[model samples]
Target: MHPSRALRYALTLLLLPLGNALAAQVQVAVASNFTAPMREIAGRFERDTGHQARLAFGATGKFYAQIRNGAPFEVLLSADDTTPGRLEQEGAAIPGSRFTYAVGRLVLWSPTAGLVQDGPDLLRKGDFRHLAMANPKTAPYGAAALATLEHLGLVDTLSGRLVQGENIAQTHQFVASGNAQLGFIALSQVAKDGRIATGSGWVVPTDIHPAIRQEAVLLTKGQDNPAAKALLDYLAQPQIRALIQSYGYGLE
Candidate 1:
């Protein structure tokens, strides 16, 4: 081989590890309802940008408290737009760095097939032993569920059967495990390819409740972190947005 070609080959080999060396790891706080889609996005983010996102999933309100208390999370993907906006106002997050990534859809779901047909009528009948939902004070989906019940004027009628979960994932588990006959959950929890992939579900109409606008923001700690910015940018990419849509969320 020519001397110049050999030197260039040696330089290329030496630089191969540089990209990995420069890659950063960011800690991300993610809302429970976004679990599945966020996991997919994180994986794609690492592969495409060589930056690893370490995700922690839970209720958005709880995450807000954690962030204010100096949690190590460098980014936040909240279940509601309000939390992010509040964080920005409190100076916990970078102003103007937040944007709605998904508009969530609520669903009445049951592990038993056909059990969720005609959701409103079923709820009005009030025959079920238990109906699970997230903690309305913390999870936006839970608030939407409450709004839905109020819209149907069944809150008082069904008050005796309500079961609350700490987060939407637990709410889903309550129904999936037969502890509750059915539950209100994020559609993404049981959906794939824009359809419910599980036993049965009724997509709650948006007109009945407040829209769950999910927002992503760069936390104050991540202001100088490349991986944090990269992850947010990755989520905004056309392909990632399409993937989010496939999981039953409407894009902003």
Candidate 2:
């Protein structure tokens, strides 16, 4: 009944096959912007290997805070390269385990017809009453949106009309629900098989916005986990990379 006794029994369980199977399941924290593709990848990883991958999606900012606060995530797939690198530098992530998983793209999208037919030109025309974007302070997609607007020299001009979502999913929701009329969301969200739809979108040229290289890192806490390491390695294999690319990500 004592705490030490309970821990001893728990440790003893690891010697059993059932305990090993459960212990080998990898827990992952993924960025909301990459939700769709990650689902595909995680499923494949689980099927090919007996090890399961449990996934959580949210703003990278929120996930990073959770990981730092000691959330039990074994792997982190972030929307930006910097966060994983920072975690490594801070000794939160496993050293030498960080790598770019995908390059993301920002899209100015509308569910309605003709509202955003020709990209930035529609923004200048300003027929829509509202626009949605993620919090630039948090979502990398939001940061890309702000950068694109600035490149078009429309930031101050459209500042009053912006409705900022907490993350990329909410931004997509606002536009899809027609609450905001238009929104800047991840290209992957609106894609069927990694290509954009025709209702109208501007695949903000990679040249304009900052390069969005989404990175992944196996945390130092999970270094000894074979499942976590295998999953990360699976992501880089030619076959898996092809699958990811088909989901609209530029794999590195």
Candidate 3:
């Protein structure tokens, strides 16, 4: 081989491991309602950036406690804007690293077709034997559910018939498995392409409750982690934003 060409080949061999070195893993704590879209985005983020995201999904409120107690999560995608802001203010998360990633829509859903016709009226009639919802203290969606119930003046009436789940995912499972006649859940849980993918659901009006603005924040643990920064940046891409929208989340 020619000397210069041979030298170039040797240099290429020396630099080959750098590619793998540049790839890293970030630990993420995500809200349960964002499960599906986050999985797809994580796959794409790995493919496009060569970095891996190690994800843990659960209630944002629980995640906040875990983070404060020194969980190893480098990032948090909270179900509500408040938790992330609280973290930022408390110094658990890096300042100026938080942003709203998705605006969630709450829905009254049932696995049975037509059971949810005129959702507000159905609640008014108190016909269902059981209604499921997440634990209001630990889940933002659950809080919204209560706010909605309060708006419709059904809180007292439905109080006796309500079932609570530990988190939004489990709450959804309750309704989906027919354990409860219906539940209040995030629209993204059973929706795609601007429609519910299965079962029947009534998209609750924005006027009834506070907006569900989900936020992402880089935890102090991720401040210097390249993969953590990469993951946050990937979430802001137009393609990822479109994917979020397809799941029935609103964007600003």
Candidate 4:
């Protein structure tokens, strides 16, 4: 072959995978607490960037554990900072990859049964038979509820009435199924953008508990992945930030 043609063919072979890499999709492990907004953001990202993102949601702790065990996740959107920070420290996450995407809020919510009005008064009055909270060990929302109750001096009072869910979604399910009279859950589960839907809820005061500051990070495994980078960047856009805020979360 002529020298120019041979070089051109070799370059084309090398460039094919690079072009394909640019079109590859990114897979993300997202927290259940971020389910709604992430779904919305994913749609916008795909539409705007021509990049696809596949999402999987569960408790942040569980997701982190899975990622550590070699789950094929490119990014992690955690419900708290600790997990992502730890991953970064361990070099599982990309160095300096962590940032707060949103600050989560918790609420005392009940389906429209009119059984519980929105307030801390329900606890003081001893009006409810059961309350659902996430498990304080692994779920950030559950830990917040525990802190809130501890602040109110109601943990001892409600000890007999408390029911714990593995995560916020289960806590919400308990309330919705009428298995629990009320529950402490992430605000995004039942409302968005300062708007409440079918359920009646009381926004738990930030003073009552530690803030659920959720942080996200790109995994080291995703460094070369465009979809992961796109998502991390997509999260900071004004429109996406506004949508996140609408879901009763604070924009970072």
Question: Mind giving the per-residue lDDT tens digits that candidate 3 earns over 23-51?
Answer: 78999999999999999999987777677
Candidate 3 segments exceeding 4 Å error: 1-18
Candidate 4 on 115-169: residue-level lDDT in tens? 5574678878988789999998889999999998998888898999999988777
User: Per-candidate TM vs. native?
Assistant: 0.93, 0.89, 0.93, 0.88
lDDT of 4 at 187: 87
Q: What's the TM for model 4? A: 0.88
lDDT of every model, 2 decimals: 0.89, 0.83, 0.90, 0.82
Off by over 4 Å in 2: 1-23
Global lDDT for candidate 1?
0.89
Clashes of each: 0, 1, 0, 3
Order by lDDT, highest first: 3, 1, 2, 4
Minimum summed lDDT over a 10-residue window in model 1 is located at: 1-10
Clashing pairs in 4: 192-246, 193-246, 193-247
